[model samples]
Target: MTVIQWYPGHMAKAIRQVKENLKLVDIVLELVDARLPESSRNPQLEEILQNKLTIRVLTKADLADPKLNREWVDFYEAEGQPAIAINSNQGSLKAIENKIKSVMADKLLKRQEKGIINQRIKVMCIGIPNVGKSTLLNHLVKKNIAQTGNKPGVTKSQQWLKAGKTLQLLDTPGILWPKFEDPIVGKKLALTGAIKDTLYAKDDVALYALEYFVDNHPEKLKERYHLTDDEINDTTVNLLLNLTKKMGFKDDYDRASERLIFDIRKGKLGRYTLDFVPSSENDEA
Candidate 1:
């Protein structure tokens, strides 16, 4: 399998721009995919955002395991990272507003005591590509102001927009780290649509996702593809081949792979979470 990594030239420039603009924001809204919460997080951004109050916004809650979504949010909050899970398509924007207000209350209070009033809270929104940052921004501002798409690298520049009377948002392009040290992390991001489809092999990602479903969600997989118990029990590669034939693609495994990946991303196999909460250092990868 090819090593999965994607860091466009613009991303390096994005890092520099984020560092330069850090001082402008009162807090950082770090959006992550709820499906792969830990894997989708950019450690580089964590390093750059040192000492800033950050709200870990777990986006795409509607497509993730509902129980796991609660668990992940609790896990982050327990570790002292203020976190909330949101479905950017229709989740409560007021919840996001309240979280920002709660974190900035102390600082805003101090400024107001000195006679500063109606000061808009400045927020820097950062996340991996396609984690729904732009959709959240557009919803907050109640305008289709940010360019949004189902693919990565859509938002390539920094721009500021207002959200209600209390918030000013500085939206930044999504950043992927230079390398994925853990191969599974790369596959997880790819499976979740964080990496562009063209950057990696679809069959490889499909196989990775297939194994995950086989292990953790067999019933959903069986139901989605009408797999028999024996078919589900076959070797993973053979299962892919069988599925290709079953779908009437006549030996076109690559097309089957693409269809399987799309089904997973579109939640046709039901809500799933690729990254489990780490219980120890050895379990983290």
Candidate 2:
């Protein structure tokens, strides 16, 4: 289960469908995982949505480090992009609505000046699977308009939900990039549950995720699992097995590893965000 490969023909068809439907959308709300915003973004999306007003919304903010999430917001804002960090379940909708309106303010004004008042700004929600697109939709409309599940790829088709007076959301099925050029991006996405777990083995993905945390945020693992940094040696499986043994799981390293993976995905490992930008020096190394 090394780096689960999920190249589905339907993804390409979905891309085509998005292109066909883009004409109907006034703005694009790109949903990204707050923990893995850089990796979860579909690279081709910018190209397909060229010239469209795009607002970047980082979802699941409660599960990510507040400092890092603010850094991401600042980074995007500096680049002339509107970004908001919102925990959808907590009724944080004003920030998202403000950003959308800010981006579409001119367009809305133009319509008003032309006597076409009360036109709803149509927004298409797009993102990789399990990035909380559906959750945000439900939070905005205050209803379960789109089907949602803990697993990835739950929303198979597009649906529209009218959100209040001036906004209507077109929910699209989560789409992945055609090719994950960066292996680290793929691994981070898989580790965070943005990609389907069944596509890869639990132990292997957990090892990769462990290595990532150990290398980037070793203190988080030490603090949460009560394991010394040295204990997180290169052999993640063995480290997890030992930790599980101490945590009261006897003679079940495999089961313990599965639980460890689930804990990481569920933010039990701590509020950590993977790198927002790839380090070129790392890639070269």
Per-model CA lDDT versus the true structure: 0.90, 0.81
Residue pairs with backbone overlap in model 2? none
Tens-digit lDDT track for model 1 on 1-285? 565466789999999999999999999999999999999999897789999999999899999999999989999999999999999887576888899889888998899899999888899999989999999899889999999999999999999999888889999999999898888888888888888888888788888988999999999989988999999999899999999998999899889999999888888998999988766774765
lDDT of 1 at 264: 88
lDDT of 2 by residue, 1-285 (tens): 466567676677779889999999999988898998788889899899998889888888998889889988888888898888888576466766788878888988888899997788889999988988888899889898888887788888888899878788899989987567877777778778877766656666667777878887888788888887569764877776777787788977667667877888777778888865444675887
Best model number under TM-score: 1
Question: After superposition on all CA atoms, how large is the RMSD of candidate 1?
Answer: 1.8
User: lDDT for model 2, on a 0 to 1 scale?
Assistant: 0.81
